[model samples]
Target: MSYSKPRNDYINAVIIPGYTYDSKILVTQCPLEETVVDFWTMVYDHNSSIVVLLDQLNRKTPLWLGRQEVLQFKDFTIVQDNSPNPEELKLILSHKEKDPMSITVFTTSKVNNDAILPSNVLLDLLKKVTECWKIQKGPITVVCSDGCSKSGIFVALKLILEKMKIDDEIDVFQVVRTMQVRRPEFFTEFDQYEYCYRCIKEYLENDSVYANL
Candidate 1:
């Protein structure tokens, strides 16, 4: 539980083990208006500096405030910063009397619930997020509508890529299996599982992609 409202310890989120790194991936559902505070609290508590949003269903409003807009949630204040990329938003999370922290939110190609993104699109987003992770050195938060579809696929693919980078090989089965053990909703549909293979095949066909990972 994050250091937020007392007795509000429950949130639809999970920390998945990372490749050669424990607790490196934080996956959670999109925050409703009521749970938005809890969502930010989780991000700050975990010291996460990067958030990847995978879809926009029911997300008519942006989670982060607009430029120069301030949202005071309990003891935390979220202030927006100028962002160059329309898809990406930057914010400073300031806790009461504590040094403010910068967080970058990356929005991927819009995807529908329980649907899959093209392999190339997925790989491109992963490259960008991985680059940011190298600097932040903190867990990356993956968000989606229910926190399991696109979030799971991205995490599994990331681990597979990391494994390939370090060991020069890939094990889609083992990676997905390990993640599914933690949350059955991961790869909930058979098509989703096949989509992982599609991503792997795409990754292998492009030599330049290897360099980015």
Candidate 2:
């Protein structure tokens, strides 16, 4: 089944295969004010419980609701539950009469546009998302303002980390090259290319940090 609905359903989003599942990722640009409802519909329809908001958005109203606050948009209602950190939000998305789905929204402002996230922070974020996926077992939605470099790099590192766990090997080059075929704008910069290798090396150096992951 395709996580990507028809063009009319949700625009500017595409499905990308993940390390363990065939169609396990939905990479998209930050939703515009007018398209926010469509974005939530995509999440609701796809049954995605994890949302990785890579960068800070410039919009007036934040996409997520505040603690214990709820917002309604067309057929969707978003409720924000308490979270341990401000960076991670627990959201419940409900459509009309269907069962409400709990989604974890991981947001990081440390990554500015075109800027790479620090290796340690990126790995920590990846580990959290990975662990969530391990228990939930579904597609992850990754969003960035422009939906290219940062989001793509995040997914690339995720796949690389998964590959390391399964095969005990790392091939940053091949993983990136393959993802680029599906989304041409992924990992577009040379620095981003180099950052992947740096992250892998860092993960190796601090094995204990992610020992459980």
The number of the candidate with the highest lDDT is 1
The parts of candidate 2 lying over 4 Å away from their true place are 1-7
Q: Please, what is the TM-score per model?
A: 0.91, 0.90
Residue pairs clashing in model 1 are none
CA lDDT, every model vs. true structure: 0.81, 0.81
Q: What tens digits encode model 1's per-residue C-alpha lDDT throughout 158-211?
A: 998888877888888888888888888898688877888888888888858656
Model 1's lDDT to the true fold? 0.81
User: How many residue pairs clash in all the candidates, one count each?
Assistant: 0, 0
Q: Which one wins on TM-score?
A: 1
Which ten contiguous residues of candidate 2 have the minimum total lDDT? 1-10
Alpha carbon deviation, residue 139, candidate 1 (Å): 0.2
